[model samples]
Target: MGSTSPPATAKCSSDWFAHKKKNGRISRCPIWGDIGEKQNAVDFEHSFLRAMRASNIEKKDFILEFQLYLTHGSPANDWYIAAAAAASDWDAFAAAFWVKFPAPKVQVRMPMEYEWILTELRLDEAKLLEHHPDTNNYMWKCNEQANWKDFTNTIKAVKKQEIEEGVEHQKLLEKTKAEVAAVQKGLWECIPPMPETPSKALGHSLAGMGFADNSRGRYGRDQRGGYAGRGNYRGRGGGPGQRNSTPLTSEKVATLAWNVALLPHHPNTSEGLQAYWEQLAAWAGRWGREAVINHEKPVLLKPGMSPVASGECFNCGMRGHQGQFCEAMGDQTLGFREREWRVLCGHNLPHSSGHSAQVNNVLDDDFDTWLSGGLGKGEGSTD
Candidate 1:
């Protein structure tokens, strides 16, 4: 039975040292501890009462011997009096001991006071509940208050919605200026006017007699009764025997009766032949220049004419020979003298004293071979 004492093993090693001396040390174990030793002993008694009232040591016996040397562990000369009381009472020792310590069941935490929960919430809900331990429902206390006229009625409702959008943009600019003055008074009552007549109102009152009073002038009623050139005084060329004899047929009525008889044969006119028979009866009653002065022919020329001969070139105006014999005037040369017809026996020779002596001896031997050589060798020879 004495051998049974082996079971004691030194009384199970003194009951495992009395259950680790009532479960305390091995670094205060919670499974191999270091679990922020009671939040570092409440941050060493809130940094030893914030370094003994910032060294002014408002002696409550030097802040109870500096909270008994930071609750007995902050040692190194109590961190040199909690670093000289956090350099002179750093804000009343960070508001009485780092915001009145106490909370610390610790899983590692210390930065306290969190600016009193960012002065009670709203800094974007206190930066989204700081690192949330449900941020003590954003704990506050540093004076609280607000509502300045609900922020001045939200800035007077955004300046009364920007002054009612500037009075609806000035009533849409006065209804776009009354619809553009009623579309310019309905386009000035749709246009119209241009009609006239009584010989186009007496050719716009004898357009100072040179006629351009529109419809290129030739005043009133002439199909064959009277007024046109006055020849009928009603009888035997007086008023009714009616005969200024119409007849003229047209080279634009002899060039509008030679431009209305050169506007009254202006040699300072003393009624130049009665203003050339009233501008040759108003250019033979409207531009048929009395049929090219009764068919004697040749008139066309008017586009800045000057001396343009070779068939009078209105740049080929009358459609035939002009632009200098126009093979579109490519090589230039058109001089023009050739109108010869002197037949004699076959009869056509007329144009004033028959000529063509073999075309005037071939134009006098081409003007004596172009005055001896200045040009004739194959004519103005460019080669």
Candidate 2:
């Protein structure tokens, strides 16, 4: 991980700030590509030394080889060549090289639009937590291309330009800050249970229709359905807070349980909605339990899924089941077997025998002859 040191007398390549060319074509350095104002002399030195060491070249040979790549016509270039010639050791040469060619600082031009500031420059907590590659790349590019001082100045210039262009970067900053705060709050706070949902209301109403709650004081009544908390089945006490004297039929209870189980707009949060559903199920007893079982595990349909022959019937608007399994048909509940009859026979016949066609007769020799006019009737008979 530590940077490899080269001989102090070694000179960096002439094309270090500029990309090198091979066969008259620009060539990318094996480590860094497209060197621009972003790269400085020190970066070239480190990269060149690492590459030379990796190639197993000796210090003396590396110094001689590096001297060959020094750019001409510059006073710094002249100093580098002279330093390499007069150097006593690798350390002395390297020290001279850096003193003569310290990395020059550069500034990057900012884009006209301010939106990229939020997207490219501003830190995003979500992206940071996710360890996004884009975020890493942006940070690396800023550091490698421009120093912190130059980058900060560029950001200031960008802000001024944005205000002059009426881009509202400040408003965007405020909005982003608010969203971050809200997300943090949601993460730290304990989630509260949702208010009474429609399903809960329906479940309560069903319980009131005479479903006895052995665990609680009589469900809809204050421990009594009549006067003086007792004996009479119906009386002045049989109002909103009073228990109903008439018990719900099994059919009514089953229907109500289904309705409660299928109620939409349950809370979007998983824990809250689950608690609400469990409470509703407990109140309705066995029927509610069945509803919960049938509704919870829904068939997931998505694009590119394998083609299926038949599934739960969507026509019936049920979940965890598909349209093909639907039982509805003009005031009658039809099972899969019953539905198959309509598909294969075109109608619901009283019996399979109602077809009125005899397969045995149709297969008889006489019937075949009658239909074919005795053509080729007998193999031995030419007629």
What's the TM-score of every candidate structure? 0.12, 0.20
Per-candidate clash tally: 23, 13
Candidate 1 lDDT over 1-383, as tens digits, reads 22222133432243433442344311111111133443544555555556444433344334324333433343333443555466454445434543344345546444566766666664653343333222221232111213444444555666777889989999998788678656754664565533675454432222212111111113343443234432222211101112234433455445534543243222324444344434433433344422422222222222222211111222221222212222322112211210110011001101122111111111212444455677545656655
lDDT of 1: 0.33
The local distance difference test score of each candidate is: 0.33, 0.39
Where is model 2 more than 4 Å wrong at Cα? 1-39, 74-76, 104-383
Q: Which ten residues in a row have the lowest lDDT in candidate 1?
A: 337-346
Superposing all C-alpha atoms, what RMSD in Å does each candidate have to the true structure? 37.1, 26.7
lDDT of 2 by residue, 2-64 (tens): 434433544344443232232222222421212343446777777667656654556875665
Evaluated at residue 201, the lDDT of candidate 2 is 45
User: Looking at candidate 1, what is the lDDT of residue 300?
Assistant: 24
